[model samples]
Target: MEAHLRVRAALLLSVLALLSLLARSSSQEIQIVNAERRIDLTSHIVKVFLTLKVENIGASPASEILLAFPPTLIDRLALVKAAATVGKRKKKSYLPLDVNPTELPDAPNGTKYFSISLLNPLSAGESATLEVLYILTHSLEPFPAEISQSESQLVYYRDSAIILSPYHIKQQTTFFKTPSTKLESFTKVEPTNRAGTDLKYGPYENHPPYSFSPIIVHFENNNPFAVVEELVREVEISHWGSLQITEHYILKHAGARHKGVFSRVEYQSKPSFSGVPSFKSLLARLPPRVHSVYYRDEIGNISSSHLRTDPRKSELEIEPRYPLFGGWKASFVIGYGLPLQDFLFESPDGRRYLNFSFGCPLVETVVDKLTIKVVLPEGSKDPSAVVPCSVEQHLETKYSYLDIVGRTVVVLEKINVVPEHNSPFQVYYNFNPIFMLAEPLMLVSVFFLLFIASVAYLHVDPSIRK
Candidate 1:
């Protein structure tokens, strides 16, 4: 009988404990719902649907709803597409995808369901979804959204993947056949979902455009979105593994956050702008055994940047053109020397020739109209040179430097784009192994010929000339 009584007492205590736990968890069952997706190609934009799901623990709907918004993915998508739409960046007030980051410690009982999206900014409802739609463009997606009073913004591939292809680029009306300029051809684009996030790039079937797969670089990407209305990068490859690269950056603020006229005071006083680096300047890595680096631009000199290298680690660190702000502009230049041996590559048959031509990108502009010219090395002897692959619709020939007719020149022009030009242009040309060497050879040959002529002239006796 005593044993039975103990069992009954234990069961009573267990029941009481269960009731208390249930009371505590009664408010934790709130859920969010109403997720949607939308894409507008007419304007070139995308939007996401989000809603809150709240369950009434007290069996009663809440009196009000308070929702917190997050701006984490804003730069990667919606806002970026919107920036591509229209000619210029849409006013932030007019933009559909602007949202502030929100954190909710504990949701109160009076609040109910919330619907949010990039479209609708705010709504008033109890136990209902507050949906808002968002929009973005490529340039705005570049980060460091705003910098301190005086700082440069550094921008590059932050949230996506790269797809390279191997193909001889097109030049005006012909093709330049070469190996170095081949693209890492891409075929198809694939996207996968790993939870709430979707990824697009590759398990990579073959290569780029064909064999190459899209390379997605998703990270905390704190860099700012910037567009240099102008940029000039000159790379010189010389003897003894010496490579010299000069960067001239003319940058303008291209962030999606600019709402109205510029605010210099607010931008300058901001602590982040004063300390953090913007995407305006970048980190350049050179081959081994490089020394004597310089950074400058059209503005003469920028003191904000510095460079350092450790012989053991063999690394090159560089700073940017200017401190990036919400809607400001600046220009600067930089130069660094690298080893020539590192640049020398060998073919299957073992041949040597100087390869110095590379490429730049198409800067999406709403203003339209642009002129760009690429100056190749003096001895780029091939009669044909492959042009860069970009949004180029028309191209023309320009003659300059030294040539019988003129070095093959290509001019590309187009407008109304956001920021896809950040990629490199693939170009190739069959270098004249013999002719590329001829410039210096010809110079030496001329010098020797002149010397011999002088000697002959002196030895010929003035009497013979008379």
Candidate 2:
């Protein structure tokens, strides 16, 4: 009996060993031959572009590549996209690959991973070059946290000097493009150089997997950090040849908080230097043939606005009642009308659809929370929305002019919205042409009844003395 029990235990141990070997073999070992990382700190948004030459070092083929990021940046990351280079050097083309968040088993240092699946598996010792673009929102921090109206706004950005990767890095370099050459300070890794507004680091030697060198740079960046805390865009579709849009914005200066009282006299006198970071006017790009544009706040319509239109596009420049300084906020509304034929179309199967651009129209602005409402015409049914990314969607009901049962409103909500989210989205629904007569017919019937009542009263002569 003892011998049999020992035999069973040995078999179990052997099985465990085989499973471990299989797991290790399945995980491909990769090495980064060369990497170039460019960090753009010219504005409040952080844009990182990475070019990596990767090789599969393991015996097995690599079907996927992993990107690592620290916990601090994972939440702020707004977009991640990667493409692989194909063909020869002069004729090189890029094929976009699928990127999605993934979990790495037994990952150390609380690192987050995003997996990019390759179209073709990379064989052993084979190399491939990849280009990656990612954007982060609200990443720059105001170093002083609070500044007076006259002080130039300076901000701090923290990042790893080394390219963060799960694989071994044979060679890597990082470059920084600052807003200006007025660099207060920056961390110096050996072989770091600064030329004009650009800073370079690395050309470092081989680094083991998961190596990291934290660095920070402090510099003057007085760009307006215009951020919309909450934006609600309402798009109302009318079959009567008009597409109306109204946007409500709660905009704020997301830069350093203001410390002292804002003096308008000082700001106006020295317009060039005083309150350099503050913003008074913002430009919005509207679709072509836009009409009936209005910019207003709670008080009334703002007169300090200009509209320029051409055959292709329209621009609306608006100024708030007061200049927006750091931490200051303003709430306003912008509404416009577009010809229905420009955006609404009817499919062959008798389905009507509306293709509209998503996201805010203001330039270089980030939205913390966005809600888009598409109010279809009354009597529409089976409404659907097609957005590029995931968003919270639900059905709502809104009453408009001469609406009988209220219009079907498709509500889409998303957070951490960037300008890249401005792609076109389609909303399709089944609408009947017969319902178009509901409003006009109702109006005529009411007018006819009124006329008939007037005639009856004239014929009856209901005066008491009659």
Return the clash pairs for model 2, or none: none
The numbered model that scores best in TM-score is 2
The residue ranges of model 2 lying beyond 4 angstroms of the native Cα positions read: 1-27, 88-90, 459-466
Clashes of each: 102, 0
lDDT of 1 by residue, 1-466 (tens): 9999999999998987776554334323233322222222112122232222222334443333233222333334321212111132364233332333322223232222222223422222323333344344452233445434344332322222221111111110101111122122222234332222232232322222112222322122233444555554544433324556665555565542333444456545774654333344444444345567555656565565554556643343434543554566765655666665655454454433334333222222221223334333444433222333233533334454333343433343433223333333322334444555645666778899999999999888666453
By lDDT, the best candidate is 2
**Model 2 per-residue lDDT tens digits across residues 334-444:** 999999999998888889999999888998899999999999999999999999877999999998777788999999999998888889999999988899999999899
